[model samples]
Target chain A: MSLIDIQRISRLYQMGTETIHALRDVTLQIQRGEYLAIMGPSGSGKSTLMNILGCLDTPSGGKFVLNNSDVSVMDDNALSEIRNREIGFVFQSFNLLARSTALQNVELPMIYAGVPKSERHKRAMDALSAVGLADRVHHRPNELSGGQRQRVAVARALVNRPSILLADEPTGNLDSKTGVEILALFEELATKGNTIIVVTHEEEVAQHSRRIVRLRDGLVAADEILHKNGAAAPETPVFPPIHASAHAGPPPVPPGAH
Target chain B: MNLSELIENCGMALRAVATHKLRSMLTLLGVVIGVFSIIVVMTAIRVLQDSIETSLSQFGKDVLVIQRNPAISFGGPEVWEKIKRRKRLTPDLGELIREKASLVKSVGMQNGLFSGEVTSPYGKTEPSFSLLSLTPDGFPAKTLSIVSGRALNSSDEENGRLVCVIGSKTAEALFPNSSPLGETIKMDGISYLVIGVLESKGAMLDNSQDSVVIIPLSTGMNRYGRSPWGLTILVQARSQETYNDAMEEVRGILRTARKVPPGEADDFEIFTNDSLIEQFRSITFAVRVGAALISSIALITAGIGIMNIMLVSVTERTREIGIRRAIGAKKRNIMTQFITEAIFLCQVGGIVGIALGIAGGNAAAYFFNVPPVVPVDWAIIGFLVCAAVGVIFGTYPAYKAAQLDPVEALRYE
Candidate 1:
């Protein structure tokens, strides 16, 4: 089964007696280990779609199946659980706890997941090291630079080992060089078979992903798959590998396919 | 939540409080004043009440005194006039109750001359001593222990001997350099030999307990007539279990001796150590209620201040709350975080208030000549009240924070 399957989903907002249709009859499927970018302008319904996919908000109608669990009808608490276990979100701004150290910020999701203290500590350390921020674990958000702060946020998103790493405008606040560095980190994570979804209006940020899904007027405008190995793996991959963990998942893409 | 999670929340709460030092301190000051007001008054009351109980206990719990007026009266001057119009208890009433009341273990007569001066060859004290006269039984009933020599014997009262027992202060004044026992002292132009000196009794209700002189009943009656102040009959019961029975027997004997008809109230007042303590407790109970009510007003005002600050905190940290929610914190977690912060502030204030209140109240206790007391129960009450106030005032703001939409809150400028 696909990791995420959304069929004809719709989201409506009521503003002073006017009904605003943020999403209307949008359908999409994402297999495991697929690096996809969702692109749109403001009011293009991409933000609404990301909110639905991240389980921060439930769809007003239609079906959303994440890991075989129907999430469109789930309540707030259930959505939180799904968000903790299956989705990792990185915001445009590095949304770190201002008072907590980098390790504490990274351990936040597992805290809600009821992970034991010692284990949570170990996993948080590993997540920070994975993002090359091992030396900055004890530093607070204000003490870290803009790029380092975003790195801490990414470590926090990855600490729970969620299936999909979802980022919304992750490098919007960084300089071009720092943005390229973050995109390289995302590319590295995707190459290692970790499923990645990024929402950005910037084409350069979207080019790092293998697939692109564009939305306009609350509907899917285009869905395209780019070939990484010329005509060999086909332009569009009908199926993606499922296991994405660095240690215990499937073998790391046959070690040097290029 | 588990212990580890609680510790994490506490750490967060502490960090938040530390960051906003001035605001937190101002918030804490309100709670401190509220708790201090309550604990200080309560501590003073507890100490004063304890001292009164100890002093009253000197008149043994099983002992009763028969007098013309009640020890504590609530009915004002009109009742005092009526009681004064009734018959006075004479020395003969002691004899009458001793002879007729079966439950009475012993009966004695006592009288007091308000203030008098005592002079020795070397020194003389000011007119500050309460001159008392009593039979031998009066010593045990008053729990007056002698430090030296002997108390009055039966022959002293029967023969009207010129002998007396001086209190610790009186002994100090009259003898200064030597023992007052067997020394001759002059009072009211009369000479008397000091037979005994009482042990020190410190002070009670701003009065020095050691400044007293005790002589035999007959001697006092002969020297200072009983026209103005009549004798008080002292009756000791066999044991505490038969105290009520003993009181009834004395009441019956006194009624018959005073010639009161049946169905009429006794012409005299009968009091026991227990009754005096009870009367004191009733009066102080009212004071306690008043103190609690007044302190509660302060606490409510402080509680309102807490709610206001918490609301402001929630508004200020709106984006932070959204970030936490997006990071997988549920509504309950956000609520816990805010409530814990509120409780942390109150607990700190409550502790400081308890310390200051104890110090302040004990200072007041010293002025009242009562021993200082540490009110453990009041301390515990102060802590629990702080927690209750935290919860009561913190809920609305925390709830508002939890209900904020994460999408909008993160977008809040």
Candidate 2:
């Protein structure tokens, strides 16, 4: 079933005698358990679209239906509740509370959800383990490597077990190797049937998803299935082989190439 | 939020504050000072009031002193007029009040011989003391209990006997190691037998009851050769219920004896313990007003300091506030955190100030040989005042914190 439905959404910005359109007449939908990537260059409204989907910003004119509820009409407090219970967000900067240790950062979302302390601790530990940072839970952001902090952020995003995981350039601050490790974690989470949506400008990061939606000038430019080889796979496979022959040669022309 | 959750949040806030020790200490400074000032002033007033009450208690219930003029004058035009017009209340007025007034139990007339020096037989001591001449009924009327030997009887006064009652200090100085009762002491080259020794009444801030000698009024009048002096008549009412009526009756008798015209103010002053307390209260009321004015100025300054520091704290904690808001904290939550912190700071200050103030007030009372008093009400008042200051001054900062947009605050560097 479609978990997110955006109908004719638009976002306008007023900046001192001029009106700027950040997102214009955007409509899209994603089904449950789908791994999708939103790819765009700077100034293409991808961030604005991500913000709208995450319920951080209201659309100027449109309907946003999340799990059959019209979230666009929700008040600030209701929106916050939905954001806490239905959607988890990962920012490009890793946005881990700098003063808190990894376990404390992972406990943030559950804290907002008003979970009891013991239950919160148990769930947070489970999330940290899922993200492969169980041993580093006590380490603070400054004390950990860039990759570990991102994992902590990921753990925080998943602690409440929200319906959708929205990541904006989740590995943008890390080295290529560390970025690969984070992408692998995302792949692992998707295999567990959690829906994941990543917003990024890097094609390499976008290539990890089974489907890519490229946006330009506040509208979708391309929506196509990613092909591993010349033939179509039976299903969107989690952990698509990293050493597949598709990476050895020229990248296989994306499905619906023409 | 549930009560337990709210309590947990408070604990979190306290932990957050404890983590930044320097900041917490600096923030608490303003509260400490504010409370301290208020407590000190209140404690001092309490101590003074207690001492005054104690001293006033010694005057005995329903005992009134009728004199020629008011005991205390405020140096106004009315007082000057009263001073000029009042005639001396002579022995005749006392005799008439004793004989004619139905409410009168007894009346003792007294006249003071100031600056009288008494010397011991050993010639080792000579201290100046107020020599008071009293009638036989004076001791009982003034509630003076005979500590040793006996008080003067009618025979002593009638025969003009040279018997005297020496105060505790005078007995100590004259006899040293021996009993002063029945001992002869020379006062200004006149030998007098000590009939009794008065118990020590302790020194007041101004007057020492332990330093005076008492003799019969007639003896004083004859020996000192009356120079148109005023007499102090102590009138004991039959009971407290008729005390006021007795006082009015004595006033009427004195007015008749003095021949005061109708439609004119009486020249004599009639004072009771209640009137003396009222007089003391009026003076202290002025002092309290002055103290409140001065202390409030300081508290105002301290309040300003609190506001200034809280504003700085709000700015500094913008990021922390943003984090809290993003984590589901409402605007009221933010407001409560800061306001609670402000009140907490002031309460701490108030407690310290009250303690110090009490100590300071009692120290002063102690130095003056007066009993110390703790003003619990004033301490409570001081705390309430500090909390009020916190709410008043902390509002703007707390409002500013609550008004911060979560998005903007999160984005703030």
Candidate 3:
């Protein structure tokens, strides 16, 4: 069974007299240990899909099964619990608390999880060290560089050992060199059996992931699979829509795949 | 929720407060002044009460004193005029209590009428010194003892002998080198032999307790003209258990002796040590109420100031709240943190006020020449009230912060 099972989810917003459809019956599935990227332009419902997947918001319609539990109808408190335990989100802004040290920011999630002090401290240190920021644990966000702050955000996301590491526009604010470093870090995490989902409008960031799911106008446009030994992914705008179903998943169609 | 988490939240709150040093200090100054105002007044009153208690205790616990006017009176000159209409308690009332009241251990009469210079062949005393005429039992009733010579006797009172007892101050003044016993002293051109020297009782209510001479009551009545209200009578009980019984006996005797019929109030007033203390509390009632009014208004205003600053803090940290909520913080967590910060400010300010109040109170004690008191009850009350102030003013802003939507707050500038 897939780790995440989404069956035709929909989201709607009412602005005064008009009903705005953010997402309309969007269907998707994600397997364990998959490094996937969801890419689309602004207002293409990419952000809405990310919010639903991360459990920050519940869909207005359809079912969301995370770890075999239907979370679509859960209340706010239950959703908060799921967000804390099952999803780790890294935002584009690297939202570290300005007054807290890097280690304290990293320990924040486990605090709500009611982790003991000694264990929380040890896990926070280990997570910071994992992101190559061991020496900067005591430094606050204002003192760290943009790249370092992003790493701190990643450490905070991973500290609670969530099921999926979901990042929204993860490298949008970083320079190319630092962006490459973060993408490489994600690649290494994926190789170590950690599921990652990066949502971005930048094709360069999507190229680093193994699978790319492209959305256009609140609907899936293409699903691409990059071969393991391929030199690079194809730079193409047009691809046949491979609408994966619940019974029968996506078929192998890329010519570069073995 | 847990100790460690509470500490972590406190650490965050402290950091936030430290970052805005000037704002927090000025904000808490209101609390300081509020707590300080009441604490200072209460503490000073505590000191004054302590000194008054020390002085009033000299009258002894098992004694009931009858006088024409109450010891401490208020309510303006009308009260004084009403008090003046009451008949004077003459020496005959003391004699009646001594003879007829079986519960009383002794009855002592005093007439503090004359204050004149007592001249000896060696030296003379200041004219400000007092001369008290007393019966034989007045020495024990007033807690006086003769350190060198003997006190007045019944023979001296009945025979109206020309004998006097000098206090330690008068002894030292009239006879610097020679013994005051057997020395001749003249008061108002009347010669009397100094038969005894009284012990020096240091002071009472800023008055010198030792600068007085004692003569027999008969001698005083004869030499100085006796008036109707010149005598004050004291009746002592055998033990603490019979104090009320003795007071009833004396009251019944005086009422009948002064022709106070049934269903009529006694013509004279009676006072005891406890009654004096009770009167003092009522005397300070207005001052206490005024202080409470002013301090409560100050504290409420201070609470408003606390609410104001806390609201500003919540608004400023909107993004921070977003980050925390996005991480994992529940609504209650945000609320707890902000309330803890407000309470911390109140307590910090309250502690400073308590310290200043104690210092100010002791300064008053020093001025009154009484032993200093800390008034720990006021300090504890100040602390609890500060916490209440914090909880009262801190909750709304914390609720506001906690109610913010994570999505909208994240996008806030």
Highest lDDT, which number? Answer: 3
CAPRI verdict on model 3?
acceptable
Taking the tens digit of each residue's C-alpha lDDT, what string does model 1 give over B1-413? Answer: 55666777889888988989999889888889989988998898788777777766657667897888776667788888888899766787788887888888888778886587889997998887878898999888887888999999899999999999988888888888998878899887888899998887655542455888889998898888854276777799988899999898888877877889999887787887778777877877877888788778888888888889999999999999888788778898889888887888788889999999999989977887777899999999999999999988989999999999988888777
lDDT of 3 at B390: 95
lDDT of each: 0.84, 0.76, 0.84
Pairs clashing in candidate 2? B32-B349, B36-B353, B40-B357
Which tens-of-lDDT digit does each residue in B290-408 have in candidate 2? 67776777677777877887798789778767666655556666787787766666666677777877887788688667767788788788888888987888788989998897656
- In model 2 chain A, where is the ten-residue run with the lowest total lDDT? A240-249
Query: What does the lDDT come to for candidate 1?
Result: 0.84
Question: How close to the true structure is residue A75 of candidate 1, measured as C-alpha lDDT?
Answer: 86
Candidate 1 residue pairs in backbone clash? none
What's each prediction's TM-score? Answer: 0.85, 0.74, 0.84
Candidate 3 error regions (>4 Å): A228-258, B84-89, B110-135, B139-232, B239-241, B258-267
The order of the candidates by TM-score, greatest first, is: 1, 3, 2
Clashing pairs in 3: none
Classify candidate 1 by CAPRI docking class: acceptable
The i-RMS of every model, in angstroms, reads: 1.2, 2.9, 1.2
Scanning candidate 1 chain A in windows of ten residues, the lowest lDDT window is: A241-250
Q: In model 2, what is the error at residue A157, expressed in angstroms?
A: 5.3
Worst 10 residues of 3 chain A by lDDT: A249-258
